[model samples]
Target: MKPGAVYFMANRKNGAIYTGVTSDLIKRVYQHRNGLVDGFTKDHDCKKLVWFEMFDDLEEARRREVQIKKWKRHWKIKRIEEHNPDWDDLWFDIVK
Candidate 1:
């Protein structure tokens, strides 16, 4: 099975956030950044790749995605800040 990743996208520091899971993290994030995918992320302009966690398989990533989705806004923010205090766009990291 393909490895998967749970990722967070935000419009800006402390701005709207979108949580998602995918087997291809780089491609998925690319779609979001380019406004290819329609839905919450597009509506909220949550295109900045702020954080992510890779899992051994898609099922594990999906489980983590569900859990994170249930978290309150503040909790999500804390998670992002803990790993990325500046909330820098991680696009370069993934591409390279």
Candidate 2:
């Protein structure tokens, strides 16, 4: 089975954030970056991949995504900063 990932995209450091889950992280993130996926990410211009966590089980990833989505904004920001203090675009890291 394909690996699954829970990811966070942001417009900039401490900017609007969009959290999602995908079976193909690279393709999904690419779509968001290029504005192929309509809705929140596109509307908010949250195209920079700032953080992600891979999971062996797609269901687990989905559950995590849902959990994160319900979190308060500050909690979500804290989680992102814990892993990515600088909020660097993680696209390079994933593609490389």
Candidate 3:
């Protein structure tokens, strides 16, 4: 199976947040940023990669995604802040 990742995207530094799971983090985030995927992220323009974590299996990544998505906003925000204090778009970092 393909490697998997759980990630977060935001509209801006302190804006709407979205959590997702993907077998290809780079490609999936690219699709969100470029509006290639039509859904909440596209509708809200949640393009900034605030955070991400890799997993050896897709199911594990997906389970984490679901759990994170259900978290209280503050908890999720704190989690992201811990990983990305600056809340920077990590796309370039990952792609390069």
The candidate maximizing TM-score is 1
lDDT of each: 0.95, 0.94, 0.93
lDDT of 1 by residue, 13-67 (tens): 9999999999999999999999999999999998999999999989999999999
61 Cα displacement, candidate 1 (Å)? 0.4
User: Ten-residue segment with the worst summed lDDT in candidate 2?
Assistant: 1-10
TM-scores of all candidate predictions against the true structure: 0.96, 0.95, 0.95
Report clashes for each candidate as comma-separated counts.
Answer: 0, 0, 0
lDDT of 2: 0.94
Q: Compared with the true structure, what per-residue lDDT tens digits does model 2 show for residues 1-93?
A: 567999999999988999999999999999999999999999999989999999999999999999999999999889889999999999999
Model 3 scores what on Cα lDDT?
0.93
Candidate 1 ranges beyond 4 A from true positions: none
Error of 1 at 81 (Å): 0.6
lDDT of 3 by residue, 1-59 (tens): 66799999999988999999999999999999999999999999999999999999999
lDDT score of model 1?
Answer: 0.95
Which candidate has the highest lDDT of all? 1
Candidate 2: list runs displaced more than 4 Å.
none
